[model samples]
Target chain A: MDFAPLLGKANFWAYFFIMLTGLYGMAVKRNLVKKIIGLGIFQTAIMLFYVSIGSKEGATIPILTAADAAGRGGIDAAAYINPLPHVLMLTAIVVSVATLGVALALTLRLWRRYGTLEEDEILARLRGDPGGEACTPRS
Target chain B: MIQEINAAILLLLMVCAVAALQVRDLMGAAILFGAYSFLMCLQWVSLGAVDVGFTEATIGAGVSSALFFAAIFRTTRRTKD
Candidate 1:
């Protein structure tokens, strides 16, 4: 019904597509590292969405400049874009790094344990498939 | 207007994302992901989030790529699928 709002904003659709792309990659890719990359892309897409919503036309950052002090009637809150989303994204970014590190570490361990990064192969090995020989049990 | 530039950047982001996923070489994928992060940083800068852009450039592009490279070196570089 309300096509106007949805059609007018291009950024939202762009971010939406990016998020979808990340999800598709995460789900379809068999390699663990590729899955991790997809997760990173998904995180960035969400961050972009949040930051985009907090933006305002003709507004500067949240920090007040000296020009604002010289202006009349104190400082107008509307002059600065919303800071909360960006602040939250900062933490999200750090968390993404931590998550990536831990995920990669786990991936490394998995690779060492199974000698393969493919999920299906790992699953097959875990299932004690005839070809994989029930994992080599490396140290 | 900044809108056109933003739109173009978003398109580039989509292309980069596809390329990153399509690439068979894991090392290449990691590099492409780094480029995607850098472009995302530019998008943030154009969107008036300079601090967020800086952090993305440093953490997303720089440190993340480094960690990815380290992992790739330790693991297999080519994807069977």
Candidate 2:
């Protein structure tokens, strides 16, 4: 099969690999904090990928340059990179930050309640195992 | 030209990501994650998304790392397989 097009699309492929790395960390890591870190990496990778798609090879920044305003020639929109993706990414970044903050807060609460961050340990406590004396009720 | 810089940055990002995942020490993993975020921010800037890059720097590299540190302090820093 022809692989030239895939080879040329380096940015997309790179970001895809990054995203999968994050997913693997989230899925396989045993620590709650590491899972959150993985989720953050995944989010950033998606945002970067979106931003890359809005760029053009020869275009300048989206802002109106002085030359564009003073020139007699009509301004061509195609001369500037697309701004919509950037705007959307800004909003997404804000939301991602807020979500990360909330996730961290919850994690702190979980840590305080359980005295540990390991998922398996916490599960063992919840299941009323012999070693989880703190979780067992007094007779 | 610019593509070469981007390729190098991507390579760094991959390395940081692997380090973050493989580090046995939780604190070390957190620090590596911060580095990974900063590298991702640079990649965004190189791709011409200045605003996104700034946001990533502030949120991903700055506030997020601070919050992670705080959470780490509040909990045990040990991770057993």
Candidate 3:
């Protein structure tokens, strides 16, 4: 099999690395805030991959520079990159922002009640560890 | 070439991600995350997704960073691990 083509697929490799890095941060990090950052990174990597896939090697931006819709002539759609991914990604970006905001708010509440942002400490407190026996789960 | 540019940006992005993950300071990690978003936005624009890139610039780099800093303000900046 010819493996040379894979070297040219920089976008694919970049996205793969970013996704794995994010996954590592989420799965291995002990801090709650770091996990949120990882989640954002993971989401951004997916969006980047989708956008890259929608691009064509010889295409221009999706917008038509001239008024071809004015009926003087028809616009050649092939000249422009596909617009569907861009539109879908707009909605995705908004959703990510909303989710980030909510997650941060929850993090704030957790910090306020527990006085720490470390996942292990929170779990310890929840389990009524000896040193954290004074801590009780808040309803 | 387009591939070279993408490779450079991707390298920088990975560096930022690693730094953000390893930093002991939460605020520093948030700032690095913002830089990561900007690099990703540039990659999107270079790949011909201007609309998606613009959205990422505003939401990922701008609003998200602001929210992270605000959240950091409410908590201690130092991480235990």
Compare the candidates by TM-score and give the number of the best one: 1
Arranged by TM-score with the best first, the candidates are 1, 3, 2
Shift in Å, residue A17, candidate 3: 1.0
After superposing candidate 2 on the true structure, give the runs of residues whose Cα lies further than 4 Å from its correct spot.
Answer: A1-8, A68-74, A130-139
CA deviation > 4 Å runs, candidate 1: A1-8, A67-74, A130-139
Could you tell me the TM-score of chain A in candidate 3?
A: 0.83
In model 3, which residue pairs have backbone atoms overlapping below 3 Å? Answer: none
Per-residue lDDT of candidate 1, residues A12-78 (tens digit): 8888898998998899888899999999999999999999999887887777545555575345687
Deviation from native of the Cα of residue B80 in model 1, angstroms: 2.3
Task: After superposing candidate 3 on the true structure, give the runs of residues whose Cα lies further than 4 Å from its correct spot.
Answer: A1-7, A67-74, A130-139
Cα lDDT tens digits for candidate 3, B1-81: 776787789889989988888899999999999999999889889888888888889989999999999999989898854
CA shift at B31, candidate 3, in angstroms? 0.6
lDDT of 2 by residue, A29-118 (tens): 778888888888788778868888997777776665445556743556877778889899889888877988898888888888887887
Which of 1 and 3 is the better model by DockQ? 3
CAPRI-wise, candidate 3 is high
Q: Between the candidate structures 2 and 3, which one is better when assessed by TM-score?
A: 3
Tens-place lDDT per residue, model 3, A59-102, is: 88877555556664346797889989889888989999999999
